[model samples]
Target: MGNEDAVRDSLLIRGGFATLLSFLLGSTMWSATHPDDGSAQLVFLSSLAFGLVAAYGLTRPTMMSLPKRATWMLILTVLWAVLAFQEPTAHYMIVALFALYLYRLPLWWGVAATAVVMLLGSGIGVVVMGSDVSVVVGPVMAGLVAIAVAVIVEEVFMVGEDRRELIDELIFTRSQLAESEREAGVVAERQRVAHEIHDTVAQGLSSIQMLLYAAERDIPDDSPARDRIEVARKVAAENLRDTRAIIAALQPRALQGGTLADALRRLATASHENVPGLSVEVTVGHRSDSGALALGTLEVSLPIMVKSVLLRIAQSAMANVRHHSGATTAQITVVADLSAGLVEMEVIDDGRGFDVPGALVGASGRAQGGHIGLMTMRQRAASIGGTVEFGSAPGRGTVVRTSAPLEGHRLESQHP
Candidate 1:
């Protein structure tokens, strides 16, 4: 049952018990004042004691184990049977018990218990009070009515619960569909940007470099202007390489036919080749020894867009290490923590680092030029519900840690 239904039932049961106890008290007082038999005082005292115990039982928590509730019900039945023998009016308490049973137990068990109570009450009325055989009729009708009411209540609550579940399911499905559409739009935009850079910026740089090289060759072999042309050609060549790298960053081709682990390994190899005297190592697996996930858990479970974001961040971090960090050895570590629903990549280098805050501030940070890459890494992580943290100081080693939620994760907070 829902929480509200359980609360309402609790109130109704307590109120019903109060009403029955009041009735029993009144009947006991009248019987005692009239002095019907020597047992009048005994019956009055017993009724008061039974009322107290039942009231205390009603105060227990509404939600109880089946065995405990059954035991309580059995005790109440025995007490009610004894009182019915002493006072005929006590037989009416059976109606209250029947309602309680119907509300708490299964339908068939409630009906059976109701039958037993009616039979026991009727026997007491006819034998102890000397009433007619028709004494069974009133209790039987009351029990049946209580059963019908209980069944109707159960049906109403079941329908409400089913409707609530359907509404919740629709809300969840709508949110997931919206996320899927947003992801698709982001991918399409990235591809368009990559294509634009390839067709315009990269192509223009290539033409400029080729023209400069040809012009340099035509000049006299030792002419002073020939050295200047060579320098310009080299500058154009470097710019062309930078442009191509930007295109690759916008849309990573390394992830096309490989998993994230393979992509990282290739990136490390390329970084080692690009920077002389720098050795880069890639490690992909769990961080702990116990409860290790499968080697390809991330590749099989993570979305392609998320994997691309991680690879781009790793590439940017590695670029910083090779170009600026001046480190001899670097480590690229990827850890999948299934329990936390997060995958983290850390790039650590024993290189000369700079002031993080100083490099991330306003125009001054932008003036540094290299800090632009750090901001780009942060933006990329934010786009995919991830975070990037830099740990470094001047003359100290640098560590870049990036984390993103795995597929199907619902993080409480997306930012740190």
Candidate 2:
């Protein structure tokens, strides 16, 4: 049971026992005033005192072992059974005992104990009042009510357990999603820093080496400054190589071989292998300066940044396809436009689709971690002055298209 429900039940049980004690005390005092007989009054007082003590003992601790609880219950039952002969109101206490027995004891044992006490109480009633057909009515009715209450409480406990499980699962899922986002952010920052170093530091070192060579050409052969200039050039060259290595290390594994087309094909092959139910195909193409389209060509050249963004987008798209799309076949397409100085990639899957607007909105807000893949893809594309679009609907398959400028080529041209 939840905390509130448990507390409420505890209060109710304690209050009920208190009320029962009050009723019994008043009934004993009334019997004393009537003075049926000295011995009868003594029996009534003893029974009332025993009941008060038993209620206190049973309700003292919040929890009790089954054996100990059953022992106290047995003692109370026998006391009430004996009191059934003397006090006229003593029989009603059996109803309260029914509730306690069923709630506290295991089902079978509770049922057995309740049945035994009920029979003993009713038998004493018949012996004293004679078989009036109403002898069994009270105990039977109380038993049914106690059973109903126990069932209701059990159902409430079951619902509480289900709610707790769902809450735990949600917490664990959110934790995993947060971890994934952190890792992705770290990787993106590393890639960005690598690209920055390649463009600024590595390029500067190369320029310095070229300038030093030019200066060495003008100097005399015996000049010591020429040797120092050559040494400086070698150092710059070595640093440039080191910078290139760092950039390579930061680059995605798929693009490490320096071939976008090959990397895409490998991605397709890997996706197909990893997702046994899905088959993947890759198409690399280019549009020439003459506006002619050529498909299935691997000679397309793209900037490193463009390749990196496109590959990451493709990875995200394929992941969605493999994990979410429920697709049987998928296709990855890359096309470079020579005239426009842009490259575009498209991932299409013939699978179940979803609401694009809703997905985008959820992704933008990072709600429930449901659309994180789409959000990451958009961010990766935006990093390179690119745009990604999704075309999808329910049962109509999905297409993720992204286009980015060739920034690396533009930078080289400006530098040259």
Candidate 3:
């Protein structure tokens, strides 16, 4: 059950239980102590009447009518006290105090009612029953006791209400915290993706532009070098196509055919064929149906911020492959496991590798900024609820790996 309903149910149950217990205790006490007195009979009847009245008042649906109820209950309690004075009885005064406690009447009203009832009941006992021995002290003691019980019950109820309000506030705060964290994660991811795109794809396109511009000036129209320029021109055009794809992938597509696998294959083919001397090979592992669903769902369902980040990561990786990797051959791998809800992608190059620390934190002597590629890649992965890592040394080639949790998305048939 919801928290608010549970609290209300508990309050009602306890209130009913307390009322019942009080009634039974008072009836049993009066029966045992004053069995012979005719006044005891009247006291018993009055207690019964008060119990019924109090029960009705306590359980009624009048939370919004509390002020009206309190005023009426106060007036009734006063009238009952005056009647007890004319024909005094122990049960009459007890019932009045019980009413005060149950309704949470004002302290002045409660004190005054208890005092007046006790004084009148004691005076009648002294005059009619000739019970003077205890009359002086007994009524005063009962009044004090009634007031104390009412105060304690009031305090307990107030504390309970305060605690319940606190719990509700805490629940609201927790919900807000969860939402804030999710938004922050999305924002952080986007920053990383943007950085990657700037470093990788942007840089690659710039280099290609420079290469073609330099070639245009050196080669004659009829020369074989001119053919080389044409090849470079085609490579630049193909690279532009891949760049456009990266942009499209970043956009939100309700339903685009071809799984993540197909997209990666197309990327690898375009990269290898477009870059004249480069050979790009892509491999796909046996994927679970669930993993495919998760990846596809992510592609289709992710918030715009997350999608943008992933696209930026892809663009950055391709850019790095073109510019930094001197190797003629490169490899891209894509793997997914549905049951595990895992999706992984890796880009490996057999190119010259540098110190990881130096690349991230530029060397002391070098004037230019350090390698931002790894940083951007890592950020992008983390933003999409994933992680990225790079493995490399001075002589060894570099490997960039990224992994993320997959949410299910329906896969559509690939178009030719």
**How does each model score on TM-score?**
0.57, 0.53, 0.42
Q: How accurate is candidate 2 locally (lDDT)?
A: 0.75
Runs of candidate 2 with Cα error greater than 4 angstroms are 1-12, 28-35, 203-220, 234-416
**In lDDT terms, which candidate is top?**
2
* Superposition error at 149 for model 3 (Å): 3.5
By lDDT rank, best first, the candidates go: 2, 1, 3
Count clashing residue pairs per candidate. 0, 0, 8
Give the alpha carbon lDDT tens digit for every residue of 346-365 in model 3: 78888776677766553122
Q: Best-fitting candidate, measured by TM-score? A: 1
lDDT of the candidates, in the order given:
0.74, 0.75, 0.58
Q: Which run of 10 residues does model 2 get worst, by summed lDDT?
A: 407-416
TM-score of 2: 0.53
